[model samples]
Target: MMGHAELKALAAAALLSLGALAPAGAECSRDIAVPVALIGVSITNNNGTVGGIYPEALRAASAKAGCNLVFSVVPRARLEVLFEIGKADILVPASRTAARDQLGIFVPMIGHRATLISVQGNRAPITSAQELLDKHELRVAVVRGYDYGEQYQALIKELAKQGRLFQEVDTVAIARLMQSGAIDVTIMGPTTFSGAVMREPRVAGLMDKLRVEPIPELPWSYSGAYVSRRSLKPEDQAAVLEVIEKVAKSSVVMEGFQRYHRADILAESVRPR
Candidate 1:
């Protein structure tokens, strides 16, 4: 059986031959990069196998669009820089922001909020960000380059200034820290948190003991994908957009989230309003 890399190479080779006969601007050949920290039920990587809601949706759309995609993994912040410089071609699980609007059109996938997730500890239950901050001894960590919301941004800024924040490369890393008691609290979606715990054997026990609660600070936000204006030629944008639009119109993104997040949480957070 052909491995993933071999299959992708074959597909790219075939696309090149078809590109000649295809109408100009109809073909999309780009290098797509998904951030490493996005793993969970959203983007799962089990050994050499890759499966998840976002990946499934994107893969199907790319094929339909005749997009020649070479998927690579990078750190969260590195993704932002790549998008900014057009070093990258496509983005998924992206949040549309005014700043990002300058980069590309956002095709929304899911609407969700980041919640306060506390690890199992003797510390008093955290009622709010300020309450957690009051205890200077407690260590807090979060996945780097992830933006929760306005309030989350402010809180992390404050935590950073106080030298109390831990920004790790990925959820699995943060989960391991929590398991080791090197971390106490994290701000992220329940789905990602659950996925991280499942991915890391050392943090497997962190699942049941996690304390999840919604705070007014971190409210709902739309997450989606975009095609960089700088990456592909202006004409090729349409093909990339088509790929994004197909995923947005389908229920695959939300369907994938349901496996990890509770129905109520999905309805309240990521499901369409």
Candidate 2:
């Protein structure tokens, strides 16, 4: 028969062996670096601190996934390059599209209501899409690479073709152009507009001069985390999706939406699908 000490030693060895055999995604030993392209806005930034709802929710989800997240803010155009080169493992708050779907898997998180914003004193009675369309003389500003839905996208394309649309890299730039009378109208989500105003003291007063109008015919745009298959292994991608799905239903994520006055959308995002 084995002695007590010998049995204890054998048990310890077995436990160690089990740990060694554990899957790579079973623990937080590895750090997943997420390269975020959306910068200078509220949702994602290079500040290296969690502030916005999307970043906070992503951080929470990473914790639940048994992995650490390294969020780096890169320019919008550079995001896909980094992922393709295996430098970034994920992209947060990415909108679902056929092109992006070919590169990775997306875990939907929240929805955003894209609203039309204009100068407060503009005399144009632009309450609907048709009214805005009738005013062909007005210059409209929009962020490049943003999808405001199919109908809005078609309108934006038509405006761009007619040279009435201005595409900028960030919202603050668009707001500044509007303040300087360079553009007559722009589209921005509530959280995004608030974040832009809050971050830039120079443009903070621009909020007072702006008014928001809803695009009633368009559906809200849903944003999610895109896990790059090129950067992450299949099992790791599965783990990330699981974590994102679980966190999307958590109270922490719901609180984030609540902070931005978007709790109703959060409820819809996490509902059974």
Candidate 3:
């Protein structure tokens, strides 16, 4: 018999295969809507339009695949809802989970780990979520819709219950809160947290006052694209998924990420998890 890890892998493979075997709609739907948010380098407003590393890479992929892709600004919560209901075609920069596996075919795009970030005055290297929980004076800010797996869920649940959690709509807002000293800590990837802070005109210096450390309970997280099962025509969906899988490691994503992160972290961001 297969071990527990192997059994989980087999179950996951079975779930993902459903995307390929699912029946495609007969209508040729080329107009695909992708949701966007102002979070780090993933999505932001550029020249009055949605632009960022994610959009940059995705736009290039869609163009190459002959897919008519449209980017619409949507909050994280509503974004999930739209995709689940078949109103959204793609979910880029979404953290993958087993529950989400039933929704679409997830193609991993980048590898990043959740980190603990706080001001310089506080403690460094929080051993676990429980450690941070003990610091009653430290207020935590969390992006409302992000799912960083089970450990994160438990941490934020306690934070919410204690009324010490300040939920924000996006990472940009969380970064601002960090700078203003309204939030003592926030947990996220280094690329995302730094990118969000640097996007502001004068908050780049916020990094100087920040203390970043690994959270033992929070492990590696992969951000990727999920092609909705009910969105595109069969041929178009396959083409889009193939093109994205390739370009996700190409210059489209790499150079776009370089615009917001250091060379080392960018390498780690795109590293195979």
Candidate 4:
């Protein structure tokens, strides 16, 4: 029975009241009053995919924990800064290395084993690490900052002794370099490189032409949730770690490996040849 103008005014007033009462931070629930921002590698193109599997997996995990989770896709440089400055609430799929641990506490429950290695079976498979020494002039592409980790630093030092020509570039750039034949070798996680190649047919032949050699004694990456001590109290940090561990053990995470193709997406999302 209310007039149109009265109803409109009522709606506006209600909206303004709701806005005033809303929480200051992104709210997942009223009971657990803590802000969370998840940092991960930025995705350039999502292909209608809703931010890729890593983010998707974290979303599922956060939901299980009854926490509101927000995502910030950042470069490795910025990510390091955020953790250092106490801005990052959580870091997903973080590699466990001593250099990184110095910045914050790395939750091992979420750790995943990944690496940046050459794609095998391109033309001839690289059988041994010594082959790198023999191919002195081989052009190598690697992601910057990734080379400095404790586990990876040794590989870089060894490659340096071999006099390999390594060019540092972004992840996508590395893939493009391989596809253009500008670089003879590039590093990629098996899952990422695989997804990229699957999306591009020509890369398949290039894969046959290249050899993927797992860098040996090289520390396989262990990814997990990491939190900045600067941003969280010990109790809150411990709670977040608990959430990560609990979600890691859940059926959703364990059973969805095949569905996610996490390993393949990581390995193949790189340059073809």
Candidate 1 per-residue C-alpha lDDT over 1-273 given as tens digits, one digit per residue, 9 for 90 to 100: 999999999999999998876654365655554443356777666675556777777887777667755666677788878888877777666666677888877787778778878765565676677886788987789888887656788999999999999999988888888877788788888777887677677778977787777777777778888778886776678877877787788887777777666665454457762
RMSD of 1: 9.6
C-alpha lDDT values of all predictions:
0.75, 0.68, 0.76, 0.53
lDDT of 2 by residue, 1-273 (tens): 999999999999999998777643554446788766553343655456645666677676677557778777766557767766777777766666666777778776666557777778737566677777778889999877665556777788888888899988878888788878899888756556656765778887875665666766454666667788787777777777776777666656545546554443233222222
Global lDDT of model 3: 0.76
lDDT tens readout by residue for model 4, 44-72? 23543335445556666556555656654
Please report, as a residue range, the 10-residue window in candidate 3 with the lowest summed lDDT: 20-29
lDDT of 3 at 3: 100
In candidate 2, position 196 carries an lDDT of: 73
Q: Report the alpha-carbon TM-score of model 1 versus the true structure.
A: 0.81
- Models 1 onward score TM values of 0.81, 0.77, 0.82, 0.66
Off by over 4 Å in 3: 1-29, 122-124, 249-251, 263-273
lDDT for each residue of candidate 3 in 96-213, tens digit (9 for 90 to 100):
8776788889887767777777777735457778889987888999888787787888899999899899988887788778888888888877778778877776678876676777
Stretches > 4 Å off in candidate 2: 1-25, 28-30, 38-41, 44-51, 80-87, 122-130, 260-273
Against the true structure, candidate 4 reaches a TM-score of: 0.66
Which should have the higher TM-score, number 1 or number 2? Answer: 1
